[model samples]
Target chain A: MRSLTAPRRDPAPSRLSYRLQRLALTPMVRVAVRRGLPLLALLLVLAVLLGDADRRAVLTDRIADLRMQIQQRDEFMVHEIRIDGASDLVAAEIGRALALDLPVSSFDLDLEALYDGVARLDAVSRTDLRVRPGGVLEVRVVQRVPAAIWRGPTGLHLLDADGARVALLPRRADRPELPLLAGEGAERAVPEALRILDAARPIAGRIRGLTRMGERRWDVVLDNGQRILLPRADPVPALERVVALDAARDLLDRDVAAVDMRNPARPTLRLGAATALRLRNIKLTELGVD
Target chain B: MTDLYQSQRAMRAMRRAAMQRGVIAILDVGTSKIACLVLRFDGPDAFRPSEGVGPMAGQSAFRVIGAATTRSRGVRFGEVSAMQETERAIRTVVQAAQKAAQLRVDHVIACVAGGDPRSYGLAGQVELEQDHVSEQDVARVLAACDMPPIGEGREVLHAQPVNFALDHRSGLNDPRGQAGQMLACDMHLLTVDGTTLANLIHCVKRCDLELAGLASSAYVSGISSLVEDEQELGAACIDIGGGATGVSIFMKKHMIYADSVRLGGDHVTSDISKGLQVPLARAEWLKTRHGGVVATGMDDREMIELGGESGDWERDRRSASRAELIGIMRPRVEEILEEVRARLDAAGFDALRSQQIVLTGGTSQIPGLDGLAPRILGQQVRIGRPLRVSGLPEKATGAAFASAVGLCLFAANPQDEWWDFEIPMDRYPARSLRRAVKWFKDNW
Candidate 1:
């Protein structure tokens, strides 16, 4: 075992033989390499081509998406302005209120802020603006109708059906003949007064003006200059009864200055300057109710 | 001291283990009402506890099995004033709710409306042992946060890791398993009065229930009233109750600040009673029946009979017009709104992305409140009603139930509370407690 572990001497090759062996292996190396070189080259070319094609597809898709986005943005920029139910609101004034010189569909448009700006207008009751397909913008405006004219510390103003101060009506001769209301905060009384007017539409023409005294009591001045004091409990019944009495005796023709109907049970009439007439226990049935 | 710490540790372990079981109860011991809700979790599908996402999904999944409310007793300004009476009230509500659910619950998560809650935002950073950070790394960074001393007897109500910064890129929702050498965490810790929390826990324990978790009532109320957009963008919720008005601010779906005004709907009633020389009951009736902030023309003549057995004929049948009633109610409502507005202003809520003010609770139901609220609040104002909950009676779904419904949502899918973290009792930071204690001490 000791002898087997000993090192053995090997013979060295000559320089010429070593050179020849190197030369002989070079051709074998070329033969082995040349046999698979085309296959390796082809694999490299295929990988390069596949990578370039994949990158090109991704770039093309991204370009298409960008173009689509640009088109959408362009369409959104063209805002169409459509007006509806503008009885008093002029198109130019509405446009000014909107404060948008560009088309309604402009991408820079802030619809919420624009709506809020329009709502700030005193004459506009409800304003709705929406964008339609194909960049068309439809704006619907509802002008507050002047239900009555209120005279207060703020001067003359138009009241909507709810008695809310709509706007300060411009002083003009051709303005609609609206009933005038007087007293402090009389503008707030417009809403309740409109409720009464709605119930008495048949006799609305008879009312000349409605005056609210500190939001406590109301006096209706008839077209005939007859002042009718309305009851706080139920003004509708009292108004109906007054209409009946006017029809029954043609009371409008009488020399009455004012009628006190604050109490539905008893109505007192003050003659022009001399006499007073009192009527008591006037029931709804006695007023010729069918 | 050792016994207390051992018990607290046991309680924490139990809560963590019970998280997967699903059903839990939240008790809100408020000054005006003691409300209880039983929430049953359907499964994990309802909510997954991931970071920087919307609310835990469990709310829509859980069904409201039982709910009961009783007028609060022995509570003032949202703290337990009388132990026995409060204990009785708590027992009554819990027992009723437990019976209704047909299951005897042993644990309860509660919210107290008091404790002078204060918020502090803390930031900390830790170097990761490995190149890639894992969940453990996040936890280690949170633990490494130099927690400010909360003080003796005060407990941490909420300790949530709100934002994370990884290798200088902040706002990363989840940094776990990400390759980074350094991790930073921005944590929000909400601390409350120790004695208030202890009293609440003792009250629940007296009723033979375990205290699983606790939240601030103002925080939960905001959760129920605020929409997802409002919470994400930023908004404030004003909950007007009988004895106190609660204020809470929400950003990124978490409560950043909370406070309460020691005045509320009850004060308005008192004003009416004193102004009109009417009984408390009658004043409340008038306030509920015809109260409006904006008076109209018809209010002057619209009369209401003062009903009672007064000896004098004039006193018995006396009548005050609606306008007179409005005159008394409007000023009080305005005062409450102004106080809330001041609180919001002090909180710098105007700087939020969206400054929405939501008015909720019983007093918010008053007519014409929305029209008048904007004048005092000076921002977008809207009346809020609790979103409808499944299996809840229609009668229980109103602005008044905001806190109760919110508690149910909280119990079903609780966000990370202080108890959820691995806090060492012995190693608790004194400095943090001192800062939190300063708030309560100064406030009280």
Candidate 2:
């Protein structure tokens, strides 16, 4: 111990007891040790999702920008649209109906929506769309052929035999070649009306058009506004009867106002107003009931 | 006899080993508590003794790495009364310190305040072979001291040359490389009860630790608590511990006289416990918090709860005035201080020119001990705490750790003693039994 206190002899005692020092290491390690990168990515995504409004908007804009970049690639731009099987005027009308801007990215356009839009035109029957090489967008359109003109409370419409819209007409005289069909269900009865018109071919000039009555049978209106009421069941055979009468007795050419063929067993005719008045005065009331 | 010599040699070797390792443990075994401290020494480059700077620098070479204290078990007056219980208590402290340090230590230097240590001062002289005194001449002179009869079951604990004289000149700190015809040395030898030392050694071994060194608590307490100037001149350190009061006198930076008193703070606690009809633990708390040697008119107004924790509401709520507590605690504290004064007086401490006394240890925490100690001990009494060591936990830097801190200093630079030097075996006394060589004594 004297060596210890020999005052200036050994200064080593200045470096003293340190055996018990410990590091606060466990807490730090608990914070650092985790399954590394994926957890960080998950945290980043959650941060973005829960962030302020501006952050969400920024993400949405970035997604849209990325989509545009993909869609605007040189090979994906649409340069032109072509319509097949249509008259020039109808084709121009189809183009106007489509209302698509050329050079728009093909990916930017919804082809199904374009097809539906162009098919809204009365002349178009079918539409096919494909993007060919060199950024050309080809549109194939089938135009509807008018089978008849339909005159209803809404006006006159030229219709195909299958009841599809061919075009809208200003006046029935404009589509004189088309068999005139009228009434509420006239459009749907276009095919039957055309068959009935064939049975009335002998009285074709006197025939004005066909009117659908109560959506069940057709009323054949001849010149001078006479009517032929065809039976609901096999109206074509009833129309053939009208044709047979017209051929055997020139029935459609008489001053008859209307012919009732609603019942196949019995057919009747109504005279003109003056004639009906004279006949009533002559005591023909048993033959005509008002 | 050879086995005993082997043991002494082993102790010397252990000290060297501790120095080499640059880290060691200091254990204070007292009747009230056992404290262990792990100390780290500075490398050779950082040790500069000139500055007199203690190891309190934040990054100083020596620092406390770990410290643990446990209530002593099966111990009385700093002596182990029950071996197994003492071993268990030692294990508790050692393991706690090891855990805190996160390292295991195999060597320990322990301090005991008991064992009835007795000190002897003797002189020896030898003619130098050459005109100059060498380390050989110093060793021969140390070997020339006449050993005293220390009675049976006692062994020399410290054999150190306190001072050296060469021919007509004296007061030589080192006689080596000096021209001299004759060399003389003053050596101090301390002896403790052999059985107690043996039990301490056995207990440490049972704890799986090697007893590298042992010191009288009184000696280390003086070393750590006495100011350097007081040590250089003359002073006495009185360590009033839980079970024993350790007293040592230092002159010229070496302990020349030492003694112990068996009654200590525990006796005062017991007095309070009995006087108030309270449990020992509660009485201890009262004594520490409210104990005073001098009471004033205001003391009666200060009250302390003498409550028992025994689940009896009436007893638990009992209160005692501070004056009454002082009445119970004063006499006991006075008695311990008086015993220390007697020991100091017996050692002829009053003859010293610089007669300062320092009081230290766990029980020295009494509020007015410095004021009370001087009334009993001396006019220049002061409360002493261990010098701050670097990185020492604030909790471990109290008067309680005086011996432990002193041990750290000693481990860093222990003075060379007779055993540290090589003496020729042929110079051994012919009849070495009943007594060791002339330089040492073994009373087995």
- Give me the runs in candidate 2 sitting further than 4 Å from their true place: A1-290, B1-5, B42-61, B428-444
lDDT of 1 by residue, B382-441 (tens): 999876667676667878888888877776666764335444322446758755665586
Please give the distance, in angstroms, between residue B356's alpha carbon in candidate 1 and its true position after superposition. Answer: 1.6
Q: Which CAPRI level is candidate 1?
A: incorrect
In model 1, the Cα lDDT at residue B298 comes to: 93
Our model 2 lands, by Cα RMSD against the true structure, at: 29.6
Calculate DockQ per candidate and list them. 0.00, 0.01
Error of 2 at A205 (Å): 99
Candidate 1 lDDT (Cα, 0 to 1): 0.75
